[model samples]
Target: MKTSYVSNLAIQTAMRMTIQQNQMDLLKATQEQTTGRHYDVGLTLGATASRSLNLQREIDRLNSMKSTNSVVTQRLSGSQGALETMAKAAEKVRDTLVTYKGNDAASQLKIQKTEILGALQTFTAAANTSFNGEFLFSGINTDAKPLADYTATSAAKTAFDAAFTAFKTANSITSDDQITVTQMQDFIKNTVEPMFTGTGWDANWSDASSQNMTSRISASEVIESSTNANTNGFRMFAMASVITAELMDKNVTPEVRAAIGVEALQYVEQGIAGLNAERSQLGISESRVKKANTSIDAQLKLVNTHVADLEGIDPIETSTRINTLKVQLETSYTLTSRLQQMSLLNFL
Candidate 1:
């Protein structure tokens, strides 16, 4: 009787073990069929978990760069457009100055003044361009407007008035004889140049900032994200614009204004030249950003491939495994059922 009871207990224990194993197999097979991946990633890639984790980290970084690059690219494009606008306006100023200086009719002079003022406004507007309400040319001070308006009461006009007055006082004469080309040269060198060079110029006015903004486009690379209004080329453009307005003011004699007009041509040429230089620089930066974006995308793709290899299962193989597990489960259930039917009456 003791032996028979011991045999029954052993059969029950074995059946219990078989049922538990079958349940685990069914659970694994169900997961594989539903998800098409091995249910146990830790078991499959335990040896490479460290490497897989590292690659995942890199992938995360690349994704972050992609998000940031979207906005960076837009800012760069906006900057480039703003620069082109300003450069074209400078060209217009240069062309109009040629026309204005050539003809001295009161009607044409008045018309040219209107045109110059319009160009000045264009320059101001270009300098103050914003993307999403943030100033593009304000450098790090993106919240600040880059240039004040060109009205007579604005800071830029006030600086010009003060500098022009000082220039006239220093020369000690107001006649055409004292305001020849030689005098124009002297005035620019001693007056306007100083205003741009020394602390007096930037201190008194100059709304445009000298600050530059930079961005990290890649892990090891940083690039300038924007250009400022206070660059040398931009400064020269401002000088030419201011000179055009001054010449149009008719504050001096016709002959004096004409001579100064000739002198102003030099500034117009320099400003145009400066515009070209700045545009070239911006073009190079744009190219760098494009290349960096490409590199980032490529890295993400390669890293994701590595991650799949490390932890992912083949769909075909997982399907085969699910079938095998189902067959084993059916066999285990059949055997457990037979064992559960055993009894002492059958043994007698």
Candidate 2:
């Protein structure tokens, strides 16, 4: 009797263990069928597991880059458009100066001044553009505005107005005649350049951070995200705006206004050239970003193919496996249920 009882216990234990294994197999097969990937792909693929993992990781990285590149692309497109508009505005100013070589008529001067003011405002607004709360042109200083409102009583205006007045005063001291290119050169070197220097001017010549935004476009490549606002082109625009801003200043003598008008005709050409050069640079960077994105997407498609080959399972085969396991598990349960109760009479 004792021996029979011990044998019965052993049989029950083995049967239950088999049932547990069948349950695990059923769950695993079901999971594989649902996901269409091998449950133990690493073990199934063996030596190729490393390659699959690498491919998967590469795909993940590419996806991340694709996301960031989209944002950068938007910023570059907007930047290009804004810069192009500024260039046209500066060109219009040059054209106007060419045509209106005479006096500062209220209506015509108003039109020219309006155009320059529009360009200046556009430049500043573009400089302060933010995407995802990041200032696109502020370099590494993503949180700061790169330019101040030119009309405000702000430090930028104050510094510029003071410098222009000083230039006029210094020239007045030197000669009572018309403004000369030589005097303009001196004013630019001594007065303008110094004000733009670090310590002399309180207002930021440019509040843009010095560090350029960058991104890894590929496994082996990095690219700049956008252009900074501190270029010589920006300086030229500011200078043109300053000269144009004094169009209606009642304090200046007609000779001084005519002298400024004369200087403007020559200076605006340089501003247009500066804008074009910078635009070319931005165009180059934009081309590279687009090219890199194309390469990234192509590589991602190929890598994804490699990953699917290594880790993917056939849906039909997975479904069959799942069904077979379920049947086997049910059979085991039925067999367990049918086991006769142990009794002394049966043993006898």
Task: Identify the candidate with maximal TM-score.
Answer: 1
**Model 2 poorest 10 in a row by lDDT:** 196-205
Query: 1-348, model 1: which lDDT tens digit per residue?
Result: 354334666767776787688678778867866765557766777877788779879988898987887888898899888888888888888798887676767788788778877887888788889997889887888888776677878766787788767776777867434565666667776777666556554654455567788889899988888887777766777777777777555645677677667666777678778777877877888889899999998888888888777767777776777678778768878877787777767788
Each candidate: RMSD: 4.9, 4.8
Q: What is the per-residue lDDT of model 2 for residues 114-212, given as tens digits with 9 covering 90 to 100?
A: 777776787677667777788777888888877777776767777776777777786675443445556655665567656644443325457786568
Query: What is the lDDT of every predicted structure here?
Result: 0.76, 0.71
How far residue 173's Cα lies from its native spot in candidate 2, in Å, is 6.4
* Best candidate (score: lDDT): 1
